[model samples]
Target: MIQETLGHLLPELELDPHTVSALLCASAAAVAALNWMQRRRIQKKMEEARRMRDLGLQCMEKAVQRFKQQNPGADPSRILSLPLVELAEKLKEGSLSAESVLYTYVDKALAVTRELNCLRHVIPECEGQLRDLQGQKEKGLLHGVPVSIKDHIGYKGHLSTCGFAPFLGPPEQENSVLVQVLKHQGAIPFAITNVPQSLFNYDCSNAIFGQTLNPWDHRKSPGGSSGGEGALIAAGGSILGFGSDLGGSIRLPSSFCGLCGLKPTVTGAIGPMAQDVGGLALCMRALLGDALFQLDPTVPPIPFNEKLFCASTPLRIGYYETDGYFLLPPCMRRAVRETGELLQEAGHTVSPAVPTSCSEAASLLSPAAAALQGCIVFMVAQDLVDPGLKPQVNCYRIPVLVKKILALLVRPLVSPSSGQLQVFYGSLPTLSPQAYRTEFIAKWKKLQLDVVLCPVLGPAFTLGYPGKLLAAVSSTMLYNVLDFPAGVVPVTTVTEADEEELLHYRGHYDDAWDRRLRKVRAVGLPVAVQCVALPWQEELCLRFMKEVETLACERKKCT
Candidate 1:
């Protein structure tokens, strides 16, 4: 009977009958072994994660306690507004010393890092740099100012892990172009901030540095891949920091953290060094132009212009509250409205502006760009890589047929809407290339408006949730598609009343969007507004951002 049963199943098996039976038994044993190995790997990873989290927490706690101990009666908010630029000016004028300014910011930065997990390294050599700068004949604009850099941006002799384990410890070389520029400007390189693994996800969490909490609300995310810079800047830990944005890396975090950020048009600001991969230096020099050269030499030689930003009169402002894909959260809506009112009141001609079709533009642009580059995939792969299981290597090593079969069998278990898969499929030749070209040209022409204001995402969702709904990122990426400059400014905080209002929201968009927006309302998250400008419009972007900032400030006064 057993032989008959085996014979009947033989056609269904891949190997010879005897071999198939032995292999089946062995496979069971192997699966058991694999499961055991997976559990062990998971356990180890969890422990490591826990340890890193705890270390970060403890450090923050101690630093905060120290700050309180030092300034028993001081208001934390007062410390938050201590302007680095002003402090540097004072230091240059001989009214303040570099040592005092460095100490104040260093002490405050230490407190912030402990509380927010915003820092990866704090330089003890900050004092040495300050002392060296004190003797300089001509103090630059940032002289004696302490500045922090995101971990991914290189600093000489510092670790440029970009928050990955393989690149941990100190790097062999000195400053990247940006770092060199900052040093040339007389800024003291005091610390390096944390970043998400691979700098992909919006939430600033990783295996190396763990998660960075929002200074405004610890439960909420600070935003990423430049989240650490945002958090540190928001908390007044740094006056200026370097951040890069492919999607919304700079803008999202800045908006979420209630700080100002600029995402220059490609080649606007400089110095992401050419990285050597597999003994080949991948040079991005062709992509570098005037836009990036203004910031660093590692970038092309673009000169900074102060005149383009100086508007002689009130400017024409184009604004929109929602992107049409996702409804703006109440706080964000209010911010846009308030900004319009302020711009109008400030003598600017504020008008309602609508792009032709945000949905079509986003759908056409993002998936193709994201997938072809594997930009977000490698960014998060390090965090997802199982230390013990060797999942990445195993996936690579498996036979193609076996891999396809396994994927087919297992895909049902995973969510169809996962961004990882979406990004993966985005690399395929399935998208109509002509459609992309036509849409890109159309979107570019439609974006002739001076600057656009829109929501970062519908409502203020938590950190982890944004990963799945990355398509909503089109609000920001719409500009990246057009190679435009964009900025993010914090407008308002979520309240119970807003939640009550969102509870009744029934939008005309898809059910997935409705669900995501509803989930966002459940959490009292901060609302942020985004401003977009045409290509090579960093000056205009900053000006529009300042206008919004003024409006936000006025609203605060009114309240």
Candidate 2:
């Protein structure tokens, strides 16, 4: 096609065949030369990253060895096993030295990342921070706790690459406000974990830092952009870490990794991830302290509400087994079912409360909301020039009429479980925002619900599934659109029964997506449910999560 076009156009321009051939050859040669130079530059950057990573690993190893030599009989396993609150207590009471705890976690983090490829850089300044912290008379809420942070959250003298090659450059001169607040709380930031390129994708892989694998099953993704923090913490590398979430970045990873995570209503809010709800609560309390607000005035100065978090009054709870759009896997539905039953058993007034379809709500609430997804993909494509995101990029690049026609062509091939038609229908909003919000809030007021329970996603999806199944994120996207404070709690693990049930699964729409979701090899992976509350009620969200965590534990014991 190119040759034919050039042949006709060249004749019109009065160009000869020989001259055209010469020009084409020269252009090809220049392109090849540029490609070679670009490849060479990429290689150099990759090598520098490798060297930095190696040096960081070596420093961590030497620090671990030094600690072992100093505390010959120390039981690092015991220290590593302690929950965040317990560990903090131990450190504050002097029962466990801060150095000993730091080294123990560092040693474990080294092992975890080697297997999972989660960590990007180990903070070498931790030892110095420890020394300074010990000299202080006051012990903060997180005194001496070793914490991990997601890749984009800045630390001094370290590159905040966000898994993109071009971002590999001079290290940050000063710590970001989040890191400074952590340090002020006496927490040591030991490492910065990996992220998907540009912090946009749900899968935790990129051109520069490679991929982060699930700790539960390497065949599956750990979930992103907080995937590294989830994998590392789930593997017992770090007890407490911070991950930012706008959609389900924090909660999805936590659900996949069998950890607890929270996402606040604040835009681009950074939240806590840990093995238990208590850890998240503790971290949330510290993050909401005066230190954070004072350090960054943009933060709402609302201190953590102890009364809301500590209240034992039974909540009027709303629960749903599935969102209207996606066909949730059997395990996901089971998690919601069992969690609601447990919450009911615990005396919370659990009632059926299925809100409007997420896509519908998004259309009514924000007409150009779907464009945000496209915009994010475009930014990632621009930043990385990486091929992993090319499929999504290409989809967005196509004309809208073409996309609609393609969707129509594939409608017959899709199963009913995919709800493809509903998705399109939802895109065309019929109700006003006031009408929709009023109706939803009426259900809320009628139920007098304190929190709502739902599924986070289908399950810990198989590796490479997220990129193909972007629509599945609609389950969590609704809460994000509404700016609700949401949290995830592990209710149970996928059982043999759940896998058997999947064989007969027919999603809400019996399309390729539903079939693919059914085919995911997810037996034995952890299943979790989302807990959501009104905007700025993060403490209440955490409190509801804590209650669910307690009930889940008791149910496990009884089983």
Candidate 3:
């Protein structure tokens, strides 16, 4: 009788409650099965990582415990102190062999690994890699350079787990295109670094390889995705490293770790097709230029334009103190303002500039949507992500109707800036990438600016805090949204004074970011400024970055 009545009603109403209930139940069961499989996969992957980590620890401990004599002529300190360019020059001149350089870095890396937990996979094949370079007649472009790779990038026979549990199994059969290019240029990638689970969050902690701490302060994260590279470089374990940046991954970590990182703008001129390319092709396009498309015919055949890098005269510099969304803390704003002043003092024309639609882009990239969906999808399809992200994932999964009801029923009784409402609104995202870029470029060119100075998402905050400040990413995410070349230069360290200024911050909005700013106490952390240039202007970007670095370096030395 119920079936007959339902059939008649379904034909009449275009829907049946019983059929809808049945479909929902089936969908729920399928999702549950997916979740179960994912959990099992993660457990296995976790065990694999744990065993490897233990092995790495034991090897490192044994090396330290044994009285191993240092190379009679190798001064690890002098070797470590030379700039990468000078070291490459020395290697080319035959003063340094690739082997010695490799060992020095390996030893340095092992020592620091115990403290930071930055490396996810230490290449046990280091000896094999060194051997291949032994008899080369001419030193390659990166001869003797020891490079660290982000874990997500592939290398032959190494699993690029990407910090996802179900992503385990099958080590890659071939090197990522970028890795191949680096090797062809004589760079030896000796280690793969850690990343946050899902590579979405800023904190460099994951359930697979554990947390990577800031070398400057244990209380803080090293910044993430490319976070391990940041920590390793900051700890002096590697002279150079490669990392991917979506928004601020490379630049933020570089800022927090007090190192220089270049995020070359994706231009059509000369780079192996970059935008939307993932895994190895992106890195190759970034460092080697688009000339490598011969190796990858799928790549956009653009070559790196060498001429655009030159700034023949002083640049017209544009500077901004905030992203018009999250107002920066005093230290972060000071870094940008000071850098602008220094450029002006050096005879560059400095003026105010802003990205008109960046905030709208940031809204589109709201973490509540991207991060929550990523975590949930990863949670349901593969292994669940980190426990730290559980709260966010759970909240995002709440039905939109439920959220609206909560806003109506619960918001009036709670604080206006409640997390629930903010999350709900932010989860409703909208993006127009191509349109935003077109508008941004037109506005930027009208300003006639060679480079723009800004902050790297405020100063590195305490660990566990950045995830909460996802909205604060407008400062860095704007450039990413624009796909302009950008770099980070550390300008100052936090002083006791900077921490107290938050209590009295009177610049802009007095919202939750302000409240969180007031509670932050991350003194001694490095403050960094980001230098940005229009697409394909990496050379100019690097030069401006150098100017900031030189000024900052000289000032610190004098003090």
What is the clash count for each candidate, in the order shown?
A: 9, 12, 6
Which candidate gets the maximum lDDT versus the true structure?
2
Q: Model 1 residue 8 lDDT? A: 76
lDDT of 3: 0.70
lDDT (tens digit, per residue) of candidate 2 on 299-389: 7899999999999998988888877777688899888888889888888899899786565654553345457656655555435454545
Find the number of clashing residue pairs for candidate 2.
12
What lDDT does candidate 2 reach at residue 360?
62
lDDT of 1 by residue, 1-559 (tens): 6555777777666555677678779999998998777656655755664475456445544654675587576544543355544555575687665655565677677778879989877765665686688678976656776777777777766667665554554564866766666666677878788887666566787666678888877877788778788788777787667678877787777767766677767722321110011000001211233423665445336444456555656777777876665565566677688777877887877778766455544545534554433543454333344231132233334444554465466556545432222322231232353565466446545644566777775343465666555555667766665666777776667778877777776643435555666666434555667877766656667667666766776787889
Predicted model with the maximum TM-score: 2
Q: Which ten residues in a row have the lowest lDDT in candidate 2?
A: 418-427
lDDT of 3 at 115: 90
| lDDT at residue 508 of model 1 (Cα atoms) | 39
Residue-by-residue lDDT tens digits, candidate 3, 124-172: 6666767788777765767767888888888897888767766677889
* Predictions in order: lDDT: 0.61, 0.82, 0.70
**RMSD of each candidate?**
8.3, 3.0, 7.0
